[model samples]
Target chain A: MTDDATRGPDPAAMLAVAEEQQARALRLLEPDGAVIYGAWGVAWLVGPGLMWLSRAHDVLPIGVAGAVFAALLLGAGAVTAVHVGRRTQGVQGVSQQTGALHGWSWFLGFATLTAIMAATARAGASDDLLALLWTALSCLVVGVLYMAAGALWRDLVQYSIGVWILVIGAAGALAGVPTNQLLMSLAGGGVFLGAAALSRLRRRA
Target chain B: MTSGPTLNGLDPVIHAESRLRITATLAAVDRGDRLSFPRLQKLLDMTAGNLSTHLRRLEDAGYVEVTKTFEGRTPATYLALTDPGRVAFATYTAALRALLRPTDGGSA
Candidate 1:
């Protein structure tokens, strides 16, 4: 019988090792999904929750709630930026370009949406209409962007979350005022938190 | 009669098990990205001396690039696969697959 040394390394075994090592390297390139989703979950849950509480129970001034919401959103953005930056540090290539472009899409999309909403508000839209417009439009932007990201990465989970967010946005708009805020806080935040947990479990498995 | 596939197409530099693992790991990183020596050693679970030896061989073949720099007060070594290295690894894997295909009757 021919021994391993005489035959050289088994081609099949070598191929298996190659596949395993490549998988490990790819895993290293991904940012921590749980941390990213958890940050957004907290922001969505608490930010809109505060606003909903203020509107529904008059527990706090709407202005204060709005400020808190803005702060939380900014905080979530910061966390995402830091996490992604750390993961890609010292790496350069098409991935870096893709990430930069995706990040800009979020900023540009929101900026444009804000401009349109501001114009509506300036043109004598009622407080009720303005509130609905802001919530629905923001959700729409997030949903579309998430789907785009999912398509780019070919991640089913991300794409599913995007679809779910769109449903929440639509339902919240139909539900109307104060209640819409509550719906978004609970439904939108719940999905983010759930996604975070799922991501963690997936990694472990 | 059809002849069986041969392993002649495999790049000798990347055919060794240790070197194959190293090359595969580096190829997975995005082009122009560098992996630190300590990180690679930990990932591969190899001793410092052993990894250095394989790395030197790869470097000699122009399939790997090693850079030394100071991070803060400490010296650090980083490794990357050159363009030629990436091409070689790709060709090697393709050849490996082709060799296995006939033995497995193309089931893959």
Candidate 2:
């Protein structure tokens, strides 16, 4: 045993060092994070937003328009996924593995969206509990898939946000919340932009 | 001119093509920013030796730091910007912006 007078490593200093390292890691992680979310914002969320507007304008048959929108959305998601995957391919050992996971999840998400649109179309605006449950489950499935992918990417905040999308979708379906889309826009798109702003500020400071 | 900051306080010599692109790429990242050598190579399309020379200059200037560790028996090189480097880049950018478009009271 050491004497009481002897000095040991300072816990506070250790914590500070860890914090600094974390900050550094965050700095390094920023680029990939921005690209991922930026692509997600433009491709995934924007497609839905555009479809909503088109439907509002009665530009085409609702079902037909939704199908076209789903195709477009899927196309966009595929492009981004493929790009990220191509960029990070063949990197042996690094967090770059997250890129592959993200790409696959994006493709999976696109497939899920297609399914949701099909199911909803078949249900024909019904207020049935079964329809709501199925939709909610679909949302949950997609959200969990995205969460897993984001976790692999080491984007914890984004992963949590993605998982929460399921919660919001399910809650909206169950509670018959009409503003579900708006809420998601705020949660998914708004939160992402906010996080980006905060990150930029931190870097500048 | 008017004593404003540059983007990264990077000297013009440092701000040459490759380094400038690298700094801009790094600056645009959110958080947890790391660039692998291969990624950097792809991004800039520079030969390994050319990239290494520029990286060395950057490291010597205290702008970037490199880490080399084994990745399952294969070695990987990671590049990160130091805090000072970030500040300098941001300052340099601000200066460039000020020069390019001076802020006025919404002047037409």
The numbered model that scores best in DockQ is 1
For lDDT, the strongest prediction is 1
Minimum summed lDDT over a 10-residue window in model 1 chain B is located at B1-10
TM-score of chain B of 1: 0.86
Residue B21 error, candidate 2, Å: 16
Task: Write down the DockQ of candidate 1.
Answer: 0.31
Give one digit per residue, the lDDT tens place, for model 1 in B1-106. Answer: 1123434656667777888889998998878678888778766778888889888878988899999888899988989999889988988899887887765555
The candidate that achieves the highest TM-score relative to the unseen native structure = 1
Per-residue C-alpha lDDT of model 1 across residues A31-145, encoded as one tens digit per residue: 8789899999999999889989998999999999999999999999999999988766656556777788988999999999999998999999998898888889988999998
Residue A20 miss distance in model 2 (angstroms): 16
Q: Estimate every model's Cα lDDT from 0 to 1.
A: 0.84, 0.56
Q: Each model's TM-score, in the order given? A: 0.75, 0.45
Per-residue lDDT over A77-135 for candidate 2, one digit per residue giving the tens place of the 0 to 100 score: 56656655665443333345455565566567667766876777677755444434444
Give the worst 10-residue stretch by lDDT in candidate 2 chain A. Answer: A1-10
